[model samples]
Every structure is written in C-alpha cells, then in structure tokens.
Target: MRTFRLYGGFLGAAEVMTKPVGLTAAWWQVLGAVLREPLPVSGIAREMSLTRQSVQRIADLLVERGLAEYLPNPAHKRAKLLRPTGEGYSAVRRLTAAQHAFTNRVSSRVDVDELRTTLAVMERLIAALDEEGL
Candidate 1:
C-alpha cells in the first residue's frame, strides 16, 4: 500500500537523519522516550506501542553501552525504572539539535497546512487500526 511505502520511507529518512547524533534510529527513539521521565521497560513499550521484549532488549543494550541506567522504583520491587545517563542526555541533546535543524530546513520547503492534513489523516488511521486490533 502507499501508506506502507510512506512508513518505510520515513523510517529510512529517520535512520539517515539521526546518524549525526551518533546513534541508530531505534537508539535515538529509545533514548528520547526516557529523557524526560524514567520509566520501566514495560512502560516504555506501552507508551511507544512497541513490544516489551524489544524495549527490554534495547534497554539492556542502553545500559550496557552506558547510555542509560536502571534506577530503584519505590512502587515496584522488581521493575526498576530506566533513566538516561549523563551520556544519554548528551546524545539526545545532540540528536534534538540535529532534528531541529533538519526540521527547519524541511519546513521551509514544505506546506504547513499539508503537513497538518497528513497528521490528521495519520491520526485517523491510527485510531482505526487501534479499533480493529492487530
């Protein structure tokens, strides 16, 4: 479908666009997910509409690479929260800067109304998908 093509294209673009931050697309996404508030891997998976196993794997990798750390959770004994490390913060900041620059460049050549319309359409599509279930 055309929409799937669009999705693939966006992912490809994101992979290239995020390289300057010194991380792969998934790494940048996983890092960004925790930059504000630390949460358990399950929480990240829930929020991102991703699988728990995948997020757990990425979380472990992040810890292994020193980009994130597991913190004690007062509410739960076993599910420790994943928080961004100082290095994680730095990488996220760099990625954010790069994204802003790229957005500025692209926004200049794109129609804002068209973008808004696309967002509306995508939101509707997501709602439909949710209603239908995977």
Candidate 2:
C-alpha cells in the first residue's frame, strides 16, 4: 500500500543514518527504552511489545559487547535489571545527535506545525494498526 511504502522509506532513511554504529532498528528501540529506564528483561519486552526471549538474546549480546550490563534486580527474586554501560550511552548520544541533525535539516524546509500535525496523524494510524494486531 502507499502508506506502507511511505513508512518503509522513512525507516530506510533512519537505517542509513544509524547503521554506521551497527545498530539495527530493533536494537535501537530496545536500547532507547532501556536508556529511558533500567528495566528487567520482562519489563523491556512488555514495554516494547516484543517477546522476552528475543529481548534477552539481544540483551545478552549487548552485555557481551560491553554496551550493557545485567545487575541483580532487588525487587524480583529471579529477574535481572538491564542497564546501559558507558559505551551504550555514547552510542545512543551519537545516534540521537545524527537523527536530530537530519530532522533539523528536513524541518528547515517545512513548516514545523505541519510536520507536527503529520506526525500526530501517523501516530494515530500506527496506534490503530496496533490495536488491530497488525
């Protein structure tokens, strides 16, 4: 569909900007969520609407690569809290800076209010799709 194409194009542009740091879209999403709040693997999975197993695998890789760490979760007997290491923080900062620069460049040519309205519409569409289990 036309909307899918538009979404794909937007994702492609984001990939081009973020791939240099070896961060896939999924990885970035997981990392960004973790950065906002240190969470157990189950918490991250629930927040991101992903499987816990999948998130654990990625978290394991991040830990092994020294980008993230697993610390004992005091609130849970078996869960481990996931937190970003210094390297992960640095990567996030770089990725966000690049994204901001790209957005600023594009926004300079467009009316900011129009851009915001378009984003609101797109977000509504995404929420609808999510509600329908798309």
Candidate 3:
C-alpha cells in the first residue's frame, strides 16, 4: 500500500540521519533509556527489549566516545550502572530540540489535534503489533 511505502521511506530517512552520527536505531534507543536514569546493563537491555550483548556493545561505544560513564553499582557485583556524561546529555538535548523543531514545522501545515490523534492511533497500532508478537 502507498501508506506502507511512505512509512518505510520515512524509516529509511531516519536511518540515514543516524548513519552520520555513528548510531543505529538500537543505539539511539539505548542511549535514550540511559538518559532517563543510570541503569545496569541488564536493566538497559530489558528496557529496550534488546539482547544484553547488543546493549553492551552500544554502551561501550558510548563510553569510548566520552558520551557515557560507568559508575559503581552497589546492587550488582558484576554490573556497573550506566549514566550519560555531560557531552551525552548535551547531545541528546540538541537532538530532542531538533526533533521538536521539525515536528513544529510539519505541524504548521496541519491541525495540531489531528496530528495528536494520528500519533495516538499509531501508538495503538504499534502496541497491537507488540502484543501480537510482531
């Protein structure tokens, strides 16, 4: 369907943006979760519904780039809590601002309530897919 094609193309564009930033969608997702709180590797993996190994790799990359740091975790003997460094927080803030600006620009041409309703529908659809094991 044309709608599916458009949605796929939008995802492709998102991938292109991440490519230049040395991040994949998975990495962004992990980083976003880390931004909320310092989480152990297993916690991050579980929150993102990703394999621990995959989350670990992304966390390593983030640490290497000075975007994140590992802190001592009292609760876990072997696992360290992950937290965003100053640079990481700044980067995420900028990225969020850009996304907000883009959304505002796009919404300028459409009714705000319509966009909100559409997003709600999309959220429900995504939830249904998850429930169906998609």
Candidate 4:
C-alpha cells in the first residue's frame, strides 16, 4: 500500500523530470540502466524488473531517436549491448542534476536518521523477497 503509493509518486516525479529532455519515465529508466555499461535488452529487463519485450520496445525507440545505439556483444552475437549516445549522456546528466536538487529539497524536510533507517528496512525487505522469490 504505502510502498505502491511511493512508487507511483516517484514515477510521476520522474515523468516530469524527464520531460524537458524529451524523454518519458520509461525511456529514462531504460537509458539509466545502461548508463554505467552497455547491456542486452534482457539484462536491462532483469535489472529493472520489467519484461524483456517492454525494454526492447523502449530500446528501439531510443535508437530511432538517436539517443542510444546498439553495439556488438562479444559474449552474445545476437544479444547486442545497448548503450547511450553522447546526446543521451547529456540528457542523463541534466536529469542527475535535477534529481540531486530534488533529493536535497526532500531531505531537508525529513530526519536523516529516519531516512537511513527506512532505507535499511527497505533493503532488507527487498533481500528477503528476492530470497523467497516473491
């Protein structure tokens, strides 16, 4: 309940934050997943907990818009790695700035200790769920 609400609110915020860069929340998510390193659509889907088909669709759109590109994967010939182009990097950087400001503003109203505790609990919950395959 609370967790779902928080996720919904975060998604809404992401949508607004990504709009200036001509990206939707889903597009930003796909781009962000590969920002650190290129990954196949399957890898992105696993990391994001989204369906592979959905990630594939977003990846295609990003490539079509010139925000990202596909590169050969030595590990898997058919599963080419997806990476962001220079323009994509620029957009992500802008989003990083905005996210930092947003975080700072939100943090100002919350107790640091409470935030830390909540994060720890959430991490534990996630780990438990993963272990249980729930």
Candidate 5:
C-alpha cells in the first residue's frame, strides 16, 4: 500500500514538473525512454509495461507536435524507430536541474544506507516478478 501511494505521489510530481515544459507525465515518460536510443512504439510499450496502442497514440502525438521524429529501422522495415527531436531533448534537459534538486532534497532526508537497502530490495522484487512471468 505504501509503495502504491509512493508511485502515485511520484506520478503527481512528474506531472507538475513536466507541465512547465508543455508535456504531461505520460509524454515525459515516453520521451525519456528513448533519450538514449530510438525504439519502436512496441519496444517502448514493452519497456514501460504499457499497451502498444497507447504508446502508438502518444508517439503519434509527439511526432505531430514536432517533439519526436520517426526513423527507418534497419532491423524492421515496418516498425519505425522513434527518436527525440532537438526540441524534445531540450525539453527533457530542461527538467534536469529540477530533478537533481528534487533528488538532493529527498536524499538529504533519508539515510543513505536505508535507501540503498530499499533500492536493492525493490530490484530483487522486480527480478523475482520478471522471473515468475508476473
């Protein structure tokens, strides 16, 4: 229950943080996923644990807004890779300072060791769930 509440809080924070950049939390999430490398909407959906159709809709909106662009995928002809445009990258980058400050403030209130242990436990839980196909 605490974890669920924490997740909701984080999403709310993300929405607030992204609003000034003209993005919603969902758009920020999808854009952040492809910052390192381009991927198809299905790929993003899989990584983000969202439906392909939902991701497709968001991807289309991003492209339409000139925040992202589609590129040819050498591996899959039909599945175009979605890459962030200059404006997209800039928008995400703009969040960096606020994100860093937020993290710093949060970390300051938590014990480092406790945080590490909690993170480790969370990772283990994720791994266990993945292994179980849950």
Candidate 6:
C-alpha cells in the first residue's frame, strides 16, 4: 500500500512537471524509453514494462504530434523503428532539466548513500517478485 501510494505520488508529480514541455507522463515515458536509439513498439513496451497495444497508441500519437517518426526497419519487414524527432529531443531535454532540478533539491536533504541502498533494495524486491511471476 505504501509502495502504491509512493508510485501514485510520483505519477502525479510527473504529470505536473512534464506539462510545461507539452507532454503527459505517458508521453514522457515513451520518449525517454527511446532516447538511446530507435526501437519497435514491442521493444519499447518490453523495455518500459508496458503493454504493446498501449505503446502503439502512444507511438501513433507521438508521430501525429511530430514528436516521433517511423523509419524503415532493415531487421524486420513489418516493424518500423520509432525514432524521436527534434521536437521530441527538445521536450526530453526540458523534462530532464526538470528532473535534475527536482533531484538536486531532494538530494540536498537526503543521504546519497542511503538513496543508493534504497534503490538496491527496490531492485531486489522487483527481482524477487519477477521470479514469482508477480
């Protein structure tokens, strides 16, 4: 219950922070997932732990909004690679800056080593849950 509440809080905060960049939390998530390189919707979905159908819809919307584009995939005939557009990069930059500012503010009041330990614990919990197929 506490974990759910914490996640909810993060989502609410993300929505507010990402709005100025003309993005929703979902859109920001999609853009962030593809930051390193172009990927098929399925790949994006896998990496982000989201459903492929939902990602497809978001990818289509991003293309319509001129934030992402579909390029021919040499590896797969039907699966086009979704690449971020210039606008997408700009939006990501803004989102990153906002994230950095928030992190900086929080870091000043938190212990960095404790934060690392908390992250490790969370990762271990997730791994354990995954092993149980939860």
* TM-scores of the models, in the order given: 0.84, 0.76, 0.69, 0.94, 0.94, 0.90
Against the true structure, candidate 4 has what lDDT?
A: 0.93
The TM-score obtained by model 5 is 0.94
What pairs collide in candidate 3? none
lDDT top scorer: 4
User: Candidate 4 — which residues are off by over 4 angstroms?
Assistant: none
By how many angstroms RMSD does model 1 differ from the true structure?
2.1
| Winner on TM-score (2 vs 6) | 6
Among all windows of 10 consecutive residues in model 2, the one with the lowest summed lDDT is 22-31
Measured on C-alpha atoms, candidate 6 has an lDDT of 0.91
Tens-digit lDDT string for candidate 6 (40-117):
999999877789999999999999999999999999999999999999999989887788887788677879898999
Model 6: runs farther than 4 Å from truth? 129-134
**Local distance difference test values of all predictions, in order:** 0.85, 0.85, 0.78, 0.93, 0.93, 0.91
Q: Residues 1-134, candidate 5, lDDT per residue (tens digit)?
A: 99899999889888888888999889999999899999999999988878999999999999999999999999999999999999999999999887788789878999999999989998999889879865
Ten residues in sequence with the least summed lDDT for candidate 1: 94-103
7-81: candidate 3 lDDT, tens digit per residue: 687666556555656565555677789887899989998766678998999899999988889999999888999
The C-alpha stretches of model 3 lying farther than 4 A from their native spots are 1-26, 122-134
User: How should the candidates be ordered by lDDT, best one leading?
Assistant: 4, 5, 6, 1, 2, 3
| Shift of residue 38 alpha carbon in model 6, Å | 0.7
Off by over 4 Å in 2: 122-134
In model 4, pairs of residues that clash are none
Error of 1 at 50 (Å): 1.1
Candidate 5: segments with Cα more than 4 A from true spot: none
TM-score of the candidate numbered 3?
0.69
Best by TM-score: 5
